[model samples]
Target: KSQEFLPPDEALEDPAQIAPGDWTLEQRRPWTGYAPPYAPDLNALETQVARFRRGDSLLVVGAFEPQEEEQPETDTRRQSMNPRIVDVRSRRNESRGERQARSNPFGRIQEEPVPFLPEEPEKTAPVQSGLFLIDTETGTHHEVLGEGPRGAFQLLVPNGRYIIGVEAFSPDDKRAWRDRHGLWQDPLVLGLAAVSDLLILKGGGNLPESLDEALPTAMPVTRIRTGESFKAAWELYGLRIGESASVRIGVDRGGEGFIRRLGQFLRVLEPDAPVVMTYEDTGPDVLGTVFRAVELNLPDLEPGEYTLTVEIELSGREPMVIARPIVIVP
Candidate 1:
């Protein structure tokens, strides 16, 4: 009982003529790649299904169920068949990606435009305080400086550089408040300074007239210390009619031989005007009262309002004139 043997390679190559024991290569194509031999038009079939109104006969080709009972419309029977429904499909957002690509020409993601913020402005420099000037000729260099209220600076030249002096503009070293209250301290050391476009002054060195040219544009600087010196610490002293009131008006630095020289009386004004109060020219008056502290005693003055103005001249500076009024009824 010997069987006829077949070779393996020939059996695999020619599987159609081989027995059932041969392994055949199964080559299958997808259903979507091929079409049915006789398929119905889907669009025409949908149209025919939608035209089924009231009564329409559907011809079942093979093993198809036929329903003679028609679907109900507006039925109010005991068993209400209309069930509540909600659509969860994202049909509205389906074309969002296509719309974004159309607006962005460079294939960039469409984004909201950002707002711009403005930058801060720059600040301006402050105006200068005072101008400085200096002069030199034939090796004789002299510095002439003038300072006071802004209008009182034109007495100085404004075109050159001068060694600026620092000074304090407060009088009454005690910080008292008054109109004539400002003093210039020791000369400050500002090595070498420069000024430009200053005004040229005219006439003599009277501060008011000399500084009138640079009136509105000049800055105030301290040059001279002019104020009331605390004469005797201001103790409440009274002057009786015939008691010979002795008042000191000069600054004597703690009696350390620092005596501010008082040469002659500047002027004598009754109510501000220079009034003539005649006394013996050489010696004291009949009452032993000499004009020392710009002082005078009234032997007989009717008793009313009297203003005493005394002008005292400083050595190498301007004369100081002080005027104060007193009301006498008795």
Candidate 2:
């Protein structure tokens, strides 16, 4: 009955030529050499439909046919199913120094590591509202009360060097001292005077003896004085960020000798006095007194203290170095 449903040409077609859809058992019977000994089982139709749903379509002619038996399993004890494991902990634990020593057994032993010490915090005096005097030589501190109007204060002590600083507390609890600019006096050397009005404090004694002799013994009455002395002074502008900050170095007496030796060369040092900016001729300015001023360009610098040094070279003598300290703020 199923063969009648197919066209006569399809029924009579060679089994290979027939479409898989029409290649029923009756059509494949001529190509297959074997025949079923039992009658067709109608109950197996459900099983065949389930197999087809499971992707086992009956289009393949001998797909379900029995295959030849596989060869017996071989026993090969010499072969390994997994890779061999290695314990490299000992080798990895070896230190670099040990490895180097192993490579060169006759080499000298490496130096022992140095112990590190934590940095100590800086100690600053607490801020207070009063007149405070610090003995620069002995580090002794003294505070005194104010006297008359304007909160005026006075201190009378034995002749010694002192650092006078005023401490004021801000609303935010921040303490600031009067150490900025030239407010703090240098070492004051007091001596006995016959008259109460006579008081003299030495200055510029720290200058190099050779450079000091080059200075004029007497001041010139005229505005313009001439000598071989070299004098450098630093003028500091504002230290705030984005502000005009610069250092003006005035070379008065020895302009010609300075130009001939240094040629406007200058060096900038860090607060620690280490040379950061090497010697570079900033070019010469023969205008009045041959003053050479360098703009600090404070915008690019971090907020901190810095030192600027000017080295004045001499033909047959060691260079005389002068340094000025400046601060920057954000």
Candidate 3:
């Protein structure tokens, strides 16, 4: 499971677990406004497998090193490939067949070709290729012939994380994609890892922005340049036209917090502070919901991944926060 293989702090129970990273692959949770176009098909699935094989596309998920109690991925292949394996779906089908045979006077049961189901899985026997969603909590899975879970944390995942199980269809992958649509059921195999730290995703600006601004250009702000100036626009709610609110746009280094006290003692160090924009909202209510657009000038920063957070707080209410992960490059 991701919790077991990923770093210890990435676990849900771990207080150090930070925000979810960019999980924009395979439309698991596309924020695009598609009146819902496209359905899972042999072609798309196969193409994805090939992409992962050739290292063209990337998938994002979680995993941590082993904790005290759990041994992640130990003898998993041997367990899944064991010659003897029984499953609930197959047993249910067999039970239904027996009932039908008992109803017939001659007691003859004819074998029927099983229909491919999107969610109702059959048996878990190893195959050359397949796609599955492994529910870590339940230790059960259903075939992903259609829609799958969309989100990083998958908070909807009961008691555990969700692991994507993608078996490669190599050596004529296209044909194999179509051939192994519903046969493979064992999800105890397959994988990928977080490459955000290694690669910068430049083409992810199409997703809807948290701040509602009628943009003049389509800039890929997901990749921010260190020490460059940029502008941000956002709408604030619950504040009257003349009411005061505090607005701030800041970059976070996550758990790698700086030792400010030590830096403060050294004037030469300048007490390392993040690039922050603070706004004094003295009832700056523009159009109904308080709106403000400010040009932000970023300070020199080390090239790495950081979270750009935009927060607005009214005097007596909870502050509305929206953030995006940005990869700072040289």
Candidate 4:
């Protein structure tokens, strides 16, 4: 058998025609005497060229012509490769059934393995009524629950002093704290310890310098010359039965004369109660201006209608009251 020889330059010019498995060349070859050269070992051929046994076809590029097929509509919102529409409504409906399967009276979910990539979640954490932050140092690791990804972000740290600091760098490209520490040679430290049952949290996403130092006492309530009052409303859910409902009142805008204390008769008649109420406070700067919450439980009444009443009190002034009726079926 004889083979045709072509230089590497000629092979490069029309490599398609000379390349093995060329459909056009194979068709032209005399079928009677022609046999394919010894087949190259695929393992070796694959290293230099792709392991394609089929003939190569040329993709013709015509003149710059308009596309015959209309370009598919591009939806920017649908760009996500793995798109999913989550209907929280259906999940909420099945949530009850899922919860029944997982939870018992002992405050523990059933020992079932978590599902793999569940489309609709059946259970979620019950929404709480107040801000409650678990103390990280207290060795208390409370599991956060809720449907949203950021559900656990609102936890309130226990009451205590906390050092508050913000990230900063000196203009000279050095850590300000580190430079100061090097100069003093004394260990630079920020004190952070929680008091018993009380947690102090640093606000504005800042670390503290000394947890031992209390936050500057808010300006006294007597600083404001003119005492003012304002009406506020809140919706509350999940009031355990027979729990004391004591709500602190505060003004949203007043400078100093805010914070009135008032609450409904506390007593829960049934399990899981919700209510809406209105309260009033003297201006800002009072104790009630910033945090105004109430706690109440009406035990005598069966799990049903609840009319929440708010009585706002001001310093050296007559008490102004607002009443809002709330109903809790379950």
After TM-score superposition, what is the CA distance of residue 172 in candidate 1 from its true location, in Å? 37
- Residues 25-54, candidate 4, lDDT per residue (tens digit)? 111212221211221100000000111001
> Tens digit of lDDT per residue, candidate 1, span 1-330?
001122235434332222211221111211112111111100000000000001111110000111122222322331123232112123366464554344222233323321111123324221111211122112222221222211222222222222222111111111110011011112212331111111111222223321122232122211111221111001111112232322222111111011112211233332333342432223223432122222233434444444333333323334344332322244
lDDT of 3 by residue, 70-97 (tens): 2223344543564443322344545645
CA-lDDT, candidates in order: 0.21, 0.25, 0.33, 0.22
In model 1, the clashing pairs are: 166-188
What is candidate 4's local distance difference test score? 0.22
Model 2: per-residue Cα lDDT at residue 220: 11
Candidates' RMSD to native: 52.4, 45.0, 17.6, 32.7
By TM-score, the better pick of 2 and 3 is 3
Of candidates 3 and 1, the better by TM-score: 3
Q: Per-residue lDDT for 1-330 in model 2, tens only?
A: 011112225333322222212322232222221211111110101000000000111100000101122333332231222132222223676774565345321123322311111123335432222334555556665554321111122333334444343222221222121210001222212321010100011123333232123122111111121221222222111112222212223222222233323432233222443433333333222211121222222234355544335444333333434543333345
Error of 1 at 33 (Å): 99
Q: How many residue pairs clash (N, CA or C atoms closer than 3 angstroms) in each of the candidate models, in the order given?
A: 1, 0, 9, 39
Best by TM-score: 3
Leading candidate by lDDT = 3
Candidate 4 root-mean-square deviation in Å: 32.7
Clashes of 2: 0
**TM-scores, one per candidate:** 0.16, 0.20, 0.34, 0.17
Distance from true location, Cα of 91 in model 1, Å = 74
